[model samples]
Target chain A: MEGMAIRLQGLRKSFGETTAVAGVDLEIRDGEFFSMLGPSGSGKTTVLRMIAGFEAPSGGRIELAGQEVTGLAPFERDVHTVFQDYALFPHMTVEQNVAYGLKVRKVPKAERLVRARKALAEVRLEGFGKRRPSQLSGGQRQRVALARALVGRPRVLLLDEPLGALDLKLREQMQVELKALQREVGITFVFVTHDQEEALTMSDRIAVFHQGRIEQVGTPAEVYERPATPFVASFVGTSNLLEGESAHRIVGTPGTYSIRPEKIRVLKESAEADQPEHATAVGTVAEVVYLGDATRFLVDLDAGGRLTALQQNLETSSEDVAAYRGTRVRLQWHRRHAVAVPVPD
Target chain B: MALITRTAGALHRRPRLRLTLLLTAPLLWLAVLYLGSLSVLFVSAFWTTNSFTSEVVKVWSTDNFHELFTVPVFRQVILRSIGVALAVTALCAVIAFPLAFYTARVAKPKWRPLLVVAILTPLWASYLVKVYAWRLILSEGGLADWMLKPFGLGGPGYGLTAAVLTLTYLWLPYMILPIHTALEQLPANLLDASADLGAKGWRTFRSVVLPMVLPSVAAGSVFTFSLSLGDYITVQIVGGKTQLIGNLVYSNIELNLPMAAALGTVPVVVIVLYLLAMRRTGALSSL
Candidate 1:
């Protein structure tokens, strides 16, 4: 990218015995909404805290707009953070909270107040400056926390699970609002989250972390469709994972594979000779789930665990399913959709 | 809102029979043991003493109160006692603050209880024994003199300094525990958030720790003031004529009970004013 907002090289951090971030390296483009997604203990939050300067990297260099910020104090860094708890000073009013950094930077009082009012309006919290954090609801407090971080006009914004504390509906609302916020501001953003859906909905790109390493970095669809490891594939969405024996080798690669349950199709009766070719697995119908638009079924595989198959409820009768439960059946999926991922040792 | 408060209030308003039963024991004790005793003192304070007979007469007089002020020693004693108590409170605050801060904020979890036990072990011992032990060290022909004999000085260190020092030692832990409790309960994240915001070290201490612990300071002051004010034994044992109000009250009551009653009113009034000021500030209610 022509203007790199933040470039981290070999960022490593450890707490006494536990190494949290181990040599993470990346460059976030200017005006990009970059997200770090991972399970707990995967060091995504540690990376965000390192960028925010709440934590110092044991071995690495962090650059923002071509200037080094690794040794900078949290306030000294040209980055602001929205914490998961929204860490608003309960004693201060909304306006005072937003004006804190500006006042510390010695922005003149008149100018600071104007900037604070504008920031409050940015988060749609205008006329709420007099209220304390305790006086506000969860959503309003989150907006106040955002305004406090944003009024400083830092080069980069770091959001650490900022919507995690909200309920489901509010989380969806804030995700859309945050996406619009990022588009309007055009500042580089480094968002950290454990929720795969939030990361997919908001990010321009996501770095999926496992243990202390990035397993893959790509757009949401790319990572979902072509997950490089079993962890990423299983973590991203629902799947009917399968283990298969090798056919005659073409390129001699290992042959373990997985397919989405939705890809499996059910046929009413046994077809004789000419059926569209796909690999087939036979099992007995173990269970069925009738979701509104689709019906899902579990097929007890001969090997062990059940294979899930999701079928559309295109017909009202489900006459085909009348014979499904406890009935022997064959399932098939297109060979191409069966993705290959590295199996762990 | 008013209706909800009334409904809640109804539940709490004491039932007439239960209230009367609960009030009976305390009311009886107060009416007889307290009020009855105070009535005798009040009457005795005004009773005239026959000049030659050395017997108290039932006739009313202001002579006891008159004698209290007419004597220079009693007035000096009153002022000295206040000075000693105030000094002890100030000393306790200074010594207790760092210990309380360390216990509440800095010490690790395992070591914290150990430090608390170490600080409180002195309190577990008998108060009389502790004061008596100090008496031996401060006396002229005691271990303090024995220890100083090598340097050719044998002197009585037992005076006003000894009394003040011993009183502070005894009550210092009392002052510390309440302050420690208050400081411990203060929202710890508030301090962490302050530091993360840009304030470091002492700035965080001044803005967050101090304001939140003001109630504790008020609590500690209450203990130190009330305790040292009522304590005449330490002064009499080690004071060696370094007069205090407590010692003055002791001698006046011993010499003439009516005179002592007149003298005792000073501390009672001071304590009442202290409580009133604390209440007005909402300091006591905050607890």
Candidate 2:
């Protein structure tokens, strides 16, 4: 962990009897964009806060740049966080807000202004320096928060759902900008988000957390394609879980198997079994959902199991989908597409 | 059902009538009672009092104002009153902030409401009893002297200092309540954000907590300042020989009604000016 920006060794935190984060170990390399993806109460934010030195870990040690900082205060650590609500100081202008960290470190006033301006420029908020945070739009306020955290050139930047307040379009746009900014500054970013798409898109690597523990840690594709557990498979993306006899009939295994919705192909029941390298399932289309670019079909298999299949609407019209509402269909997919995972308790 | 629904619909259609009904009572009370009496008081301030008969003369004169400015005793009393009011306000603020912050931010969730109730419990007690209790505490050999005697010190012994201390204790709840509410409404995330941005606890309190709570502090001060400005009872009990503007007004009310009215206008003017200054600092919105 010498070259890592942040390392958590057996990190844990408990609020009385309820443990929030339990024995989590992670090594986030310097300059990499890492994300903790989980549902609420899964301890992702707690982990990020511990790294930023806000929450004292109940057990174990936290090393920032190879220096143990478990008992240190947030300001004592060379890290900063962009909070979920942006937390812009209402009384201060954007420049003052951005210059706060520098001022705390006793940076000269002239240099603080220059560095704040530079940081604001990096976030494309150059003219927003004089404006109060309340005067800015939500997206602009989030950018100022980012600038404030970034101005100090912290070793690791912890962001707890910084873009959670933005609307869909703005959130997507910020995702791209944040990724680019991470690359431009080459600073270690430890982001926390509950939105799976956000984690997949913005993160170089992601740790899927569940019940105060890391279920899986991998790159976006690895976590999505080869999810380590049933929790990861179900949480990271759209996964169709099959188990027991259905698992055996579908993938020749008697245990649980996970398949992606997009990987399953739907064909007319009477169509020739032309693709022999693929496994087959015969089921009636239980439900159909049209989602602009794709159509999702809930198929009830003959083996008493139901699985969902999503097909691109590239060559099919609404009429074609309606015609298949009650019709029988054959679901086909490569044998390699089904992944075996542990049964969740 | 139809009658009730129809009536509701009719009321919904006529928002103006509903608004008028909602506002009429308070508006009338303000116009007829509060403002009406205030206008009468200010009008009487301009009239003259007969020197021999003690009758308020109708002739427009500035004699009271002239005396208020020219008389050394009046000037001294006015400045002393303002000084005492300011000291009380400052002491209340200094005491209230930490107590409010503890109740709002630092204390456990189960204890917060209890702490607030403890702070407010004093308000329910009799004001006279509380003042008399303070007089006993400040008496030459009362609790204040007993507590300080071992430390090689003596109590303030019923002087300006005793008045100030008593007034601060009396008005503390007024200061604590608004500051506590403001601090309660302060988002916990803002403090976390400050800490996350590398600000120490004290620095965060100064730069983040103080500015945001200033408006509430000013609002609380409005209560303490104005109340202290017009209060003659506590001073009479504990002030020894101190003569504030309130004491002057009370002494003059029976002998010279016009002079009392003129002197009464001072606290009102001071409060209004203070509110105006506070409004410039955005305290009105917080209130």
Tens digit of lDDT per residue, candidate 2, span A1-345? 338898889999999999999899999999989999999999999999888877889998999998999999887889988999888889999999999989988999999999999999999998889999989999999999999999999999999999888999999999999999999998999999999999999898999999999999999999998888988998888868888887787677698888899999999887665667788889999899988889999999998688899999999888778888888999888877888887767
> What DockQ class does candidate 1 belong to?
incorrect
State the lDDT of candidate 1 residue by residue for A1-345, as single tens digits: 569999999999999999999889888899999999999999999998888777889999999899998998775677888888887766568898888777666689999899999999999999999988899999999999888888877789888899999999999999999999999988888999999999988999989998888888899877777777878887776655665433212113445565678887754336431355566666678887777688888987655456688888888445555557887777777766677877777
- Which has the greatest TM-score? 2
Off by over 4 Å in 1: A56-58, A88-98, A103-121, A124-136, A246-254, A262-282, A291-294, A301-306, A310-324, A327-336, B1-86, B132-164, B182-188, B237-242, B254-265, B276-287
Every candidate's TM-score, chain A alone: 0.89, 0.97
Model 2's TM-score against the true structure = 0.95
Cα lDDT for residue B143, candidate 2: 98
Indicate the worst ten consecutive residues by lDDT in candidate 2 chain B. Answer: B191-200
Clash pairs, candidate 1, are: B81-B245
Error at B180, model 2, angstroms? 1.6
Tens-place lDDT per residue, model 2, B128-228, is 99999999999989999999999999999988999999999999999999999999999878888788777788998999999999999999999999999
